[model samples]
Target: MSNTAAVRIDDTPAPAFSAAPMKIVVVGHVDHGKSTLVGRILNETGALPEGKVEYLREVCDKRGMPFEWAFVMDALQAERDQGITIDTAQIRFATQFRPYVIIDAPGHKEFLKNMITGAASAEAAVLVIDADEGVQEQSRRHGYLLHLLGLRQIAVAVNKMDLVNYDQTRFEVVKAEIVAYLNSIGVEPTYVIPVAARGGVNISENSAETAWYKGPSVLGALDLFEQARPATDLALRFPVQDVYKFDQRRIIAGRIESGRLKVGDTLVFAPTGKSARVASIESWGVQSLSAVSAGAGQSVGITLDEQIFIERGQVASLAEAAPAVSHTLKARLFWLGRNALKVGSRYKLKLATAEYAVEVIAIERVIDVEDLANHPGAEVGRNAVAEVVFRSRTPIAHDSFLDNPRLGRFVVVEDYDIVGGGVIAEAGGIHQAHKSANITEVAHKVDFETRALANGHRGGVVWLTGLSGAGKSTIAMEVERQLFLKGWQVMVLDGDNVRHGLCSDLGFSPEDRAENIRRVGEVAHLFAQAGMLVITAFISPYRADRDRVRTIHPDVFHEIHVAAELDECEKRDPKGLYKKARAGQIPEFTGISAPYEAPEAPELALVTTGKPADESVAELVRYLEANFSLTARNQTESWGF
Candidate 1:
């Protein structure tokens, strides 16, 4: 049905081109003629093999169905039977300008994951829209996704114009709607043209059906788009893959992801601040070379001048352009997990060659793709986009997504299955005492046994975590008084009192709250190390933040959950916070606007809903005395007295 002739399939090798093939992904709503358009392009460019179209036509006849251009690309039997593309298919074709690899991605919502996988690597995109149907939800979603994936070279093809009788007014209406939506999402489409893909009208040449329209055809628009520049011009980023030993030399092997590397360049391994110079470049089945230079996309092995301990997952870069080293980062994530992505859940963050155990600390906001609206939420549902914050136990090296995409992109894995993908928007600086590189920990001269013998008890931290109005400070004060009266060294670090001095500069934002907890946990650990019972009462809502404190001193950290129902806490309203939060006076108030992640397992749980304060204090005191008291058991064996 196309005006152009289709070429026959050949067995001889095809002619080689000077440049690498440009990859383009075709996407849109289902039943919008994405496959049909791709098939038309193949035929118009004479890229289809001989008898291929006839063979598919015969097959359609046998099945008692009209032959369709979509069948040219939808080669799978299941896809032909179902009349839908379930997976992505790649095909090679050439025009007068250059060769191209067109990726026909599924347009169905259920196959969006496959579409993302295909489009993530594409340099350009052709978004197909049904002219008769105007703009649909999936059409807008696909446009937003292309923008999110950083594809700017886009061409919108208004297909199925024959159904609308090739009316110029109808095509203009569809084009305007799509253009406005794409522009709102910061995507400026290079071209928007009307074409009837079924009969190949206006695919390779301008059609007379739309005499008023004067835009280029689909193939012409593609030729006008520019190719992406090579990444070799960017800063060097070489993530170490492995280290091998050959006789007396140790060879470091990895592919240069960006920029260039040469012999004698001083490279710094990130997060460790270790530097080494490249001495020689190594190659297999080739003669030894000394001053070899390598650019991006080349895998090379090099020997360091001075052998320092280096391992896989360490990124090598110049000191001036080294990646950020931090324990916390902000990301724009697309979650695909069956379970909702919530705060405090743990996942393995795989970025470049490094993998870190990361926990979600906050979900800033979830974005609705249909309306492009942002809503504050506690969790991200399946196939939703959200801005989230993640914290790792140790520092990890990475670049911002805009600075270098290779090191910025990451995937979240839960239980050995990839559940989410994202890009690092921001990397937070070191805020924890343990993360500080300049500080050195000093050891105490007096041993634990000496301090315990003098104080009559061992050092430990009693951390009470709960929602507001949970009687945490009330019970902590009472326990402190009782322990002090019994001639034991005890101190209570009430949240409000500490915030007046130590955390005076912090606000109530999620980042500031996490930092406040880190400071408090460090101070509590110090007090406990001095053989004192340090009691901390605070509304530590995030389980990940509390779990981080436990890791500081696992043996001495005692997490006590002050269990209180939300309604009861609201009814009590100790500080009038619940009332203000209800009145919309306070923002991000826990148990009202924000979230509270209860501890899955704690050292103790006290139900303070209706119980007397004295009873709760008595129970807590008994727990402490039984666990921290040196005289409760054999002191000689327990403390090595």
Candidate 2:
């Protein structure tokens, strides 16, 4: 737990960096020799750690298979049975210079998610493109994912030269195609090696074949090439990990992404765009030095000159040009989504350790790798390349994935699951606040305890919604008054009440409706966060829109719909508005002039058409108590802002 709210402490062990081990992630399609190439390197270099070879040979022997090179890396039963790499296996090697840890990732369509996991943290990538099959869809996607993960530094291994009889034309053809795709994805390989892993050609040492190609061998690139800078080192960046308080002073701890962060140096937070001065630099559970300076790869804690509130996902910088912050942005996505990247779809975006719900407003275009141009994608209800525009629910400081990659990438999710992964090409300049969003000190004087005490119990959002006149607002007010008088910090976000004040300028269009619901949901979320029981009474009317709201909470979104019969609603005449709505007084009235999508399933149901307001309020309060903590906490989610 953090002393301050927002930051989350991860339990991953400190990286084993006493020796500054270099990591290379091997990625390519199935049967493209990713495992074979790794096996060949381990064998030729005698870098098979301990009993890897003998154990793999025995496993192969017992399994009644030939001692193929692939067996050395394919450790999982599913991979061995399928004769393919299923999961990434970490194998260490030394090349008489730097110790190398080989990351072997799968190449099949079914296992692309594993590929992402393997490459997400790699310093560099070894993209294997088959000489015979050339560049396949998976190859393109892997390249895209590498770029998204901010690992642009790459080397290509043109494998299976033996199958092409070591033909120079074949290698050149595949190399040309691979190069084109790489450039499209904004990566140019440091070098391309023509190798036959099965035949030990151009792997560790040069083979008798491929003498026609003068490029360095696969081992040569790993041994002798220079690597591009790590993303965290390209810019002066520090992602907030945790904020600790001791002796009434707060210390912020995190890794330095780039340049240098030192004690007493002035720093700015990106996305939030706030500035502060470092008071001290501490390490190893002790203060290292007063105003100490450090470079990339060091985890240090710093005390600010004063209490300038900061939280997780905020980037600290030492440069004049702070990173970009925005409300919404456009992203070019490589869809690994189980569901297609469709227009108007909602998803959860996880960047670093923070996640948010975002909607894909439009699919602008899809890249045709072969054509080398982007067209409106064939969302064809499957994962494909698409240029998507999204509107976020809150302001987020964003960087172009190509610029400062550590903060530029995102994942798309549906419900609570990850559906796609992507890199940001552009942070919507439109969303960048020309004026700052200051954190006002006067909003509420109530602390967490005060709000909790006032609420009679812990306060949260009981987001009741449905079609217009579904009795959402009416029941919500009655519920709010009941909770309020019972010593609860209760508030109702009625649709009309909001439209007249906080959302006065907003109109009733689908886009405006989405924005309206999104804005209200964010406010309610904040209210709940402050430990207040917020009753939101709005006719969200669409399942997707309601779903979008449900995906926001750090916990669960407790949705209770005020489901009422249409004829009964028309007959009640509580406000005499339903009759006027049906008589053409309203253009898009729910249950009459506009569409109303009833909740298919709700945590609690209420029939408000004929029910008394006081009675309905009593029922709502009981429902809130029972389902106050329920949220659509899908592990997979996306945030638009």
Candidate 3:
């Protein structure tokens, strides 16, 4: 939002003209003439270079393509090589009403994630639906998403009218269908224009093809309307993307959301509760005399009046209405990860400029994003709209997506992968999401030293891997009770027991089993975060999957092999699941239909042939005490459990 590099998109400083350029993006389904519409606009307005259109035509002839409209977004080599609009692209055009900076986005399902980079910053959206195609899936979806993203002003350009014989009736049919869907999704397009972008009808100039319809042209509708920004003009909020400091002067770089900032004004930092005064505002080496007041669309760097500790994540806000900061968060999630979102999917939650480890606590309910009706018992999966509860490893200052988008939206990343993106509807919930690296009381702040005293030496996951009726849970619980008696702060996450509460509705598919282990791993990690030794007993049969669980907790996880042969485990038949599996009652019964992969490397292996729980508990205690200590708090109220 910096004007020094690019002129402001909308607002003008004086009455003569608006300095903020009118930037808009046109997005919809493929083959709907989005790029052609842009090309037509540029051609009619003379925005493109004299030879650019001819070059495109020549390129299309060489490639033997019929000059599809989507080719116009080939600003980068990667885009042309991929033969798809891999990212949101921008181009400029002018109408009698206003000049526009248009962003053309991809419509393919595979590239919807890429669409976000374009739509996230736009003031309004123009959905191009094919007049013949009516409201396609992406059309309805884009409309719904536009509503969700809080883009208020909308205008629909029903293109391809020429294909429908330029019939106003055909245009009306598509218009009604789209209007119905948009209204159902809580969006009312200000105007719907029937035009053929390729034929040059009703683009920048009026078209005579649709004489039956007396509506405005595409450019007419846009020119007639004015830009409407987010309401309330809330306090100035900007998320620091990066911090640059040299020669003892600090500069924080970010985009402004609303309101303004001036020099010598008091500012507060989020989640950290720190405050400082702005000494100066500088951008492009120009020092703003009024640094305390910076309007929206302005990106400025400010120097503190007093020397203060700052970080990339910390939010600078007005002294009033401090941003919420807490580890526990409850919000609606739109799961877009390659795998279904379930309990124990731990990843980094990137809120504002800060990223922290996060876990899915409870899936309140999964709803179909398209239908809006709640799916009473839906488990996590791709493209699901669920009201899920999650917690972050540390407190982050953020506002609700409904209230302030400047600091409300966030994306979750797993290592280098962007798995999920969500809005913070609310934060600082009933449970605390704080954690410590170690197990016992200690003098140090690092997790290693505190863990040295908590569990006795070092902490790790005791993964009990076996088939059903292998007595993993029974032994795990018994050992936990003995450790509790010996003054060990131990937590037991039983695989089946957890399902009865946290994961009651999940089924027993291969994917479901992996989700179960993942959830258990995350819960055990929380217990470890609380400075307690956690014992996890599940039939986590897959060695690679079990290894995946260990990676989640790192040094705090230990994979324990509960070696009970299939024949011996079936004889025990404690749960009768084995008998049912053999009788064809269950499809995914381990030791019958499903295969259980044993661990190649186990920190502790207990042969499950009637080994007394007491002996197993003693052996676990000795091993854990030899390596890790039970960690404890060094000071009162250290935010460590």
On TM-score, the leading prediction is 1
lDDT of 1 by residue, 1-641 (tens): 12243321212222323256788999999999999999999999988999999999999899999999999999888999899998998999876666799999999988878888888778899999999998898898788778767789999999999999999889989999999999987899988989999988889878888767677788777766677667798778999999999999999999999989888888888655567899988888767655489988989888999977788988888766788776678998878889999988889999888899888888998888788788787899987888898977556788887678778888899989888887887655532212333667687799777888899899888999999999999999999999999999999998899889999998775556776887899899888888888999999877757876886667888999999999999898989999999999998788886678888899999999999999999999899988899878567754321
Q: What is the Å distance of residue 235 in model 2 from its true position?
A: 2.8
Model 3, residue 171: distance off in Å is 2.4
Q: Which stretches of candidate 3 lie over 4 Å from their true place?
A: 1-17, 63-65, 75-84, 228-233, 238-258, 279-309, 326-334, 364-373, 376-378, 425-641
Tens-place lDDT per residue, model 2, 176-294, is 88888788777877788888988888776666687776656676667544445654467677878889887877988888766677777778765544577888887655554444787
lDDT per residue for candidate 3 within 1-641, as digits (tens), equals 12222222222221222345565667888778787777787787888888887888898799787775555666776766666566777887765445678888777767767776677767777889998887777786667666656676788999998889998888888999888888876678877888898888888656678777666667666655566544337756655666788689888777666556678766776544456788877777655443446766787788887765667777777666556665456665556678777775677888766777667766777755456566646367765556676655445567777667777777778668887666665644211122232556555355644553544533345667777776678778877777778677777888878989887867775545655666787777766775677788788755545765675555667777777778888898988888888889998677676567777778888776777656766776677665454343332222223
In terms of lDDT, which candidate is strongest?
Answer: 1
Q: Candidate 2, which segments miss by more than 4 Å at Cα?
A: 1-21, 147-153, 180-190, 230-233, 282-291, 368-373, 377-381, 427-641
| Consecutive 10-residue window with the lowest summed lDDT within model 1 | 5-14
What value does the lDDT take at residue 7 in candidate 2? Answer: 13
Q: Give stretches of model 1 more than 4 Å off.
A: 1-18, 287-291, 426-641
After superposition on all CA atoms, how large is the RMSD of candidate 3?
A: 11.7
Question: All models: lDDT?
Answer: 0.84, 0.71, 0.69
For model 1, the local distance difference test gives 0.84
Q: Which wins on TM-score, candidate 1 or candidate 3?
A: 1
Cα-based lDDT at residue 507, candidate 2: 74
**How big is the positional error of residue 385 in model 3, measured in Å on the Cα after superposition?**
4.0
TM-score of 1: 0.66
In candidate 3, position 142 carries an lDDT of: 69
